[model samples]
Structures are given as structure tokens and as C-alpha cells.
Target chain A: MQTEEEFKDFILNGHLHYIPNVSIDCAIFGYHEQTLKLMLIRHRNMSSWSLPGGHIKRSETLVEAASRNVRMHTGLDNLFLQQFKTFGDPNRIQFNKFDKEKWFEITGLTSWEGNWLMDHTISVGFYAVTDFSETVLQTDISIAECAWFDIGSLPPLEFDHSEMVKEALHTMRLHLYHYPIGLNMLPEKFTLSEIHALYETLLGKKLDVSNFPKKLIALGLLNKLTEKRSIGAHRSPHLYSFDREKYTLALKEGLVLS
Target chain B: MQTEEEFKDFILNGHLHYIPNVSIDCAIFGYHEQTLKLMLIRHRNMSSWSLPGGHIKRSETLVEAASRNVRMHTGLDNLFLQQFKTFGDPNRIQFNKFDKEKWFEITGLTSWEGNWLMDHTISVGFYAVTDFSETVLQTDISIAECAWFDIGSLPPLEFDHSEMVKEALHTMRLHLYHYPIGLNMLPEKFTLSEIHALYETLLGKKLDVSNFPKKLIALGLLNKLTEKRSIGAHRSPHLYSFDREKYTLALKEGLVLS
Candidate 1:
């Protein structure tokens, strides 16, 4: 935990050194238990949730700022990130008088932070894929909690975060149809059914289970491992891992997973 | 042309009402004579060229500002446009000391306009496809000329405009492979070879000419017209137009042109 003085210094002046009016928001998605989930943080003072995001430093690229935000929230780095869109609706930062007063009361931040938050901000939206179980959640000083929610059911989000999430899902679906993406979301040596489940959740529809493995194998992107795992009262299923060389080639060649 | 005072007013106080620090740049692509081209404007006082772009209005979306910029240069409205990326390097608006002095000399823009121009500007990039022969060139007062240069060869561009163009072309190619394009770049009725040329130029590679038409026809996107286009010493090729209904369906269903 940071001291009050340190927190004030970080929030009030830390961002002052960075580029003003430009920010980055990340939709860091993880897949587990046959469901798609997004990481969100609840503000310490407010009940609404928001995606992990921060201002871009003067020396870094927009994408670098997004990566930094991901690390700050999840304690993970080098995730597979892609820039999907830039949201610059001028009214995005507008707040009603009541809302402004409520924010001041909750945050105990006077004019400086209030004006900084209300600036007409332009945010670049990026989406990242990572293994759900691998990340260590780290809530920032201003966040009450950090958690992952099923994309199908999310809490009321702050600002235009809901719109940003919708756009990220749209971009992910488009990419899934044309690219090999499950590798980033799954653990090593996973069964064929696991990979299929990941795709089904991402596409929001069921794919032919029997044909899914065939299509993926045809792309020559997976290596069937010698080891197998047995379920109770059932025969063993073989484990599989991505053949990095072939997977890289398939990404460039454009694999049609659907 | 407006007087110098009006020009300065338009550049300075005219845009001051809009949101600060955010701008829009467009790569207006057109197809003509079996070549893909991009619209560029030469600054009145500089040798370097740049895309037709403008600052976002306080009331408009980023895309809306891009459309306005396209119309300002081409004298055409409602062109098919797609937002590709946003360029937000902090050093983007930074000009060398010599260039700054030179700009003040040439444009007679003192502190206000100069500061506005040098403000750390973040620009959203959009690409629009239009028929080359249909546009009327309209050069703004600050522009020496507005013209189209073949995508294969372009002049020296200003700031990070060259990087923006490269990104736009990359996005266009990626979109071309997964979507039904070229409708905006071609005339209402066009020969199969003409459409093929457009795709080949955009993709930067020659596709099998015989197989290209078969793929497009297979998608049911082309409506066979009763007319034919003539070529000397060869049989006239049949003309075709996009079947709007089927084309819209294919767009949703994902047409893989590759």
C-alpha cells in the first residue's frame, strides 16, 4: 500500500509529466472453463467498474502505455496485444453537475484531479489475449478490487467502457475467423475439446465438435503430444500443443478457423 | 480565394472552438488506368506532400471529421470510408527550430496559429476508396496542389504521413482479403479485368486472372450485365455490376477474396 502523500503525488503529478488529453484503455481478455472473460477494476470510491487503463508517457508509443496498464493490473507482461480502434467521441468526458459533485465527494480530490479527469480525452482501445490462470491480480491504490467477469454478463461499467468492450469483442470475433488465436488463451498440452471450447466461447456459437479438430489439424498448427489424460469411466484423450513454427506460418498465411 | 485575414482566421480562431489536441488524417485512395493511387496535397510553402486531413470539430466524431477532410480535397461526399488506425507519437507535431521560423515567415502565423500547429496533436487515420475519374480537385488556400499519386510510387511526405500511408495500405490489403471491396473504386459498370486490376493493384501482387472472376462470381456478388467493354484486336469482355443484396450478405458472411 502506498502512503497518502505518495498516492497524491502519483495521481496528481505523475500523470502531469505524461502526454495530456491522450490515454489508452485495454480490454485484457482471458479464456477458462469454456467461457470468455474480461479483467476489470472497481474504483475505490465508486461502485462502477472500468477496464485497466492509463495515460501515455511522453516518451512511449500508445501501445506501450496499454502494455504498462496491463502489467499494472494483472502483474503480467508481453501479452499478445492488438490495437483495434480509437474512441474519440467529444462528449465522452462530459459529466453532469451531480455526477461531478459525487466524484469530488468520493475521491476527495479537489479541482486539479477533477479537471484532469474531465478533460476531453481521446483513448486508443487495444485488446490483449492471455492465459487466465497465469496472471496475478494486483489492484492499484485507486481500485477497490480487480477481478474477471464473464463477458456475457458484466457489471455496470464506467465512462464508455461498455462500448469499448463491445468493440473489442467484435474485433476478436473478426480476428478468430481469419487467424489462429487460441494458443494465447490456452495452457500448454491441452486437449482438442479445450481448444474447441475456447473457439465456441469466442465465436458465441457452437461449432461442429468433430470437425473442429480436423480443421485445426489440417492447418498443421498443432502437435499431438504422446501423453494423454483419462477422464473417469472414459478412454484417454490425447494432449496437443501448438507447433510454434507451423503456427507462425499459418498466422502469416491466414488460417480460416471457421 | 479568400483574403489573407480570412485564411488566418480559418486556421486560428476558426478551429479553436473544437476539441484541442485531436486531429484526423485520411488516405483517400482511388483507382484509375490499372493503377491504385492515393490523394495527396502539397503544402503551399513546403516541398513535402501530405494526405488531406483536418482537425475534428467539437460536435463531430473522428470519422465525421475524416469525411469532411475528404470532401474538402476531392469535392466529393459520401465516399466509402474506414478508420484504420490512430497516430499519436508525442513528437509528431514537433518541428525543427529552422522549420518553425520558416513557417512563421511563409504563413505569417504568429504565436497563436503557430502554437496551435505545434501543439502535441494525435491524429486518427482513415482510408476512403473512390472512383478516380469522378472527383473534382479542390486545393485549399494553404495547398499548392491536390493530386493523386500511384501507390507504388509517392513523393516525400510531411511528418509521419508516410508511416500513416503504409499503415493504411496494410489495413486496405487485410480488409481486401476478407471483405468484398472495389465497389467504390470502380464505375457503376466495369469489365471483369478492370475489377481484377484494381484488386491486384491494391494487393500489390498479380492474381490468377482466370480464377479471380470465378471466385467473385461464386460469391454471387457480381451481376452479369448485358453490356460489354471493347478492346482493340480482341473480343469485348462482358460487363458486370455489384448485386447489392447479395453483396451485403457476403459482407456479413465474410467473403475471403484470397
Candidate 2:
């Protein structure tokens, strides 16, 4: 939404075009140079940060809605996305905390009872991983600011978002064992040490450096290239790249890596 | 619902007490004697089978609604339940196939365009594992029949349920590698071969017999008992049971087994 009229109409009659009582929230993880970060946004008239979210359109699928939300905020597309969980606690959104006065100024309404936007909603959570250095953050009329924060140091978020981030990280780490990652975060041809560092940073732990690369090679997801990058005297390490066919197959039919 | 009046009220005014446009479907897997089965139900006016499902109450969480649906059909509780996926496709439900004449008899309405139950609904898919031998199947006014079908010989299902089953089984098998299973499917005290059979049946594949038990032992999820089961005078094998503390810990914080 861009204009005041659109915002007012959405708050009042969005259910005509979008599904009511159902929304989609995304936990977009950014990785670059062995540093991990998360994307968060602050809505207009809100004091705290929150995950970028919106309701599903009446004509779109769940994943399409999520992808659209992510694309709108990050200016990136085709990221590796996966659904982590669906959260539906009745008390998840405390309505008493809603800023009714500010909303009244925008919506021109004193009471929101029986409104489509005031009902209890269930949100589907999706997680995506992309290279932070490649994204250009964007904001809309409803969002006051959009930025990335270090994973270790994050401000207190609004609603059940803190729990959503925790669950998203846990599920993403578990998925590392089953699915293939690092497609967008790494160069087309990289060294073993580079990929190892990527994995360690995403997992938030140290892996046995010797055993990590070997597992990926054994799974046929990686292929050794004859080329090598020269850094110093007697310090050239062999280069490797993902086998696109095998990597795509492993993604569809999961394979154990650890 | 048990009576005609209650069913009529649910179709006409259920949105007053239940959340509309959100439902829950369960893929209940039953394991007994090296055989795996799935629970399927047929509605009163439908010919095709479907995973047993219902809507969520205003006061209940998502999981609670799923548990209640499972309990109503299986006559059991506290099974190992998990949220596999939430399905929301625009064309997932074929309303043209709906038996409008039969519904008209109960609802006394020729058109259900604005009815709460006739809207596009998104269903949350949950998978559960339990011992089928312990459950006594029951049906309500809406369900005409409920029974267990061997997993390998399931007939065609309705409303994208076959896809739901495929996804559910894929997730359950993937979960087998991370979480502790076989808690309710196996006897309190079982032989290594017994658990081995159970895994094979559920995975629908053969595993190397030698390496399976050792992985469980190394994880500290199993304890060997001194007593042995005497199948023959010359062939007596040791019995083992789950380490409750370690198993519970593993369930909370997942561990790799394969």
C-alpha cells in the first residue's frame, strides 16, 4: 500500500480481496562473509520491530503470498524458501496493546469490533536464506523502517515474533542435515574452507573442519574442479563447485549430509 | 455432532463458535506386528475416503483441534502427533463435486454461496503414529464409515488428500531420523529385531540389520536388560527398553540416529 486512501481501504475492506484471519510471516536470514543477519521492519505508529508479514490474497497460494512479501521487502527473488511452522495461540496477539487512537486517526473509526482485521488470526511461518550484501531494503506506507540486524544482537520484537525466530532457526538448522543450502551465499566455484565457514556460521557452531567437506563430496552434491586459486607460494587450494544435477536431485529427494 | 439438529446448526451457524476458513486434517498412521496402516474416513454423502478432519473451535489451539479430531475417530489420546504441512491452494477443493442436493436437505437452502462452511478453507495437515490394535473406531453424524487401510494398498482419496498423505509420510520418515519414535508402537520391553522391523515397516525400505541397533545404543536412547526373551533353548536374545530420561531429552532437543 502506498497512499492514505489505500491504507484506509485495506484496514476497512481488505477481506474482500484477501483472506481474513490468515496471514504469512517470513524470517529472512542473510549470510555473507561468514556473518549471519536477520531482516526486521517497524510498522508506522509501532514502537517495536516485527517480521515482514501480510495477509494472503484471495487468488494466490500460500507460498506465492510468502514469496511476494519477501520480494516486496528485500528486492530479491528466487531465494531458497521453506515453510517452518504455523502459529495459532489465541493469546498470541494481545488486542489491548493495539494503538486504537492512532488507528482511529487513520481509519476514522472509534470502534473496530466486528472488523475483519480485528479478529483472531493464524499465521504461517516461512524462512528464507539469502546473501545480505545483495539485497536492497525497501519499505511501504505501513512500514516506517526496514533494516537488517546481527543475529546475536536483536531488539525485542512485537507479538509472538521472538518465538517465531527461535523456531525458524531451529527448523533451519535441522533442515541443514536433510536439504542442500549455500547456493546463493557462496560463489559459483569456491574452496572447501569457504563452504565450511558458511556452514559453521549458519549452524551457530563449529564443525569438524576435516569431516565437513568430505560429507558433502561423498553425497555427490559437490564436484572437484581441476582449477585451483593461487593465494601464496605452496598455498593453493583446489576449487570445487556444486553438481547442479545432483544438487537439484538432493533438494527434491533429501539426502543425509552429517 | 451426534444428532441431525446439531449437524444442521453446525452447517448454518458454526462460525459463531468455530473459526471459519481454517480446518484440520489428520494422517493417522498405525503400526502393529510389522505392518503399517493409515486411518481414513468417508463422509455420509461422499463415496471417496478422506483423512479424518474437522474445524477449530474458537477457544482451542491448532494442535488441540487436531487432537480432538483424532480422538473422536480413533477413541485414543496422547498419540505422537506432529504438524506436517498446511495446504492452501485456490483449487484444492472442487466445489462442483459437492453434493448440493443432499446438503440442501439438511440446510434447507438451495444456494450456499454466503454460508460460512462453503468458503475457501485452508487445512492444516497433522500426522500421528499409534498402535491400531488399541483403538476402537467410532463415527459421528457426518462420518458414515471409518477404518484402517494398509499403507501399501490405499485406495484413491478425495480433495488433494493423496498429496497430503504423500507429504505427511515424507515428513514422518524424515522426522524418524531426528526425533525419538516407537514409543507407543513398540512393547515396553522389545528385542532389537522388533524395533528394527518397526522402522523398516514405517520407512517402507530395508535397512542394514547390523548398524541400526548400534546407533540407538550410542545415542544413549536404549538400555539393555539382563533378562532375555526365550524363543528357543539355543536362541535367547537380550531385551532392551528406552532410557526414559534420555528419550525425553532427545524428544525435546532432537538428535540424529541415521
By TM-score, who's the top model here?
2
Runs off by more than 4 Å, candidate 2: none
Q: Best lDDT goes to which candidate?
A: 2
Q: Cα RMSDs of all predictions?
A: 3.8, 1.3
For the predicted complex of model 1, DockQ is 0.51
Docking class of 1: medium
Query: Global lDDT of each model?
Result: 0.77, 0.90
Candidate 2, residue A94: Cα displacement in angstroms equals 1.6
lDDT of 1: 0.77
Looking at model 1 chain B, report the run of 10 residues with the lowest lDDT sum: B97-106
Clashing pairs in 2: none
In model 2 chain A, which range of ten residues has the least summed lDDT?
A91-100
| Candidate 1 lDDT, A74-190, residue by residue in tens | 888877677888988878854552244544454477664445455667889999888788788998666688999888889988888899998888777777766677776888888
Off by over 4 Å in 1: A1-15, A97-99, A102-114, A208-220, A224-239, A245-258, B1-3, B10-15, B105-114, B208-220, B225-238, B245-258
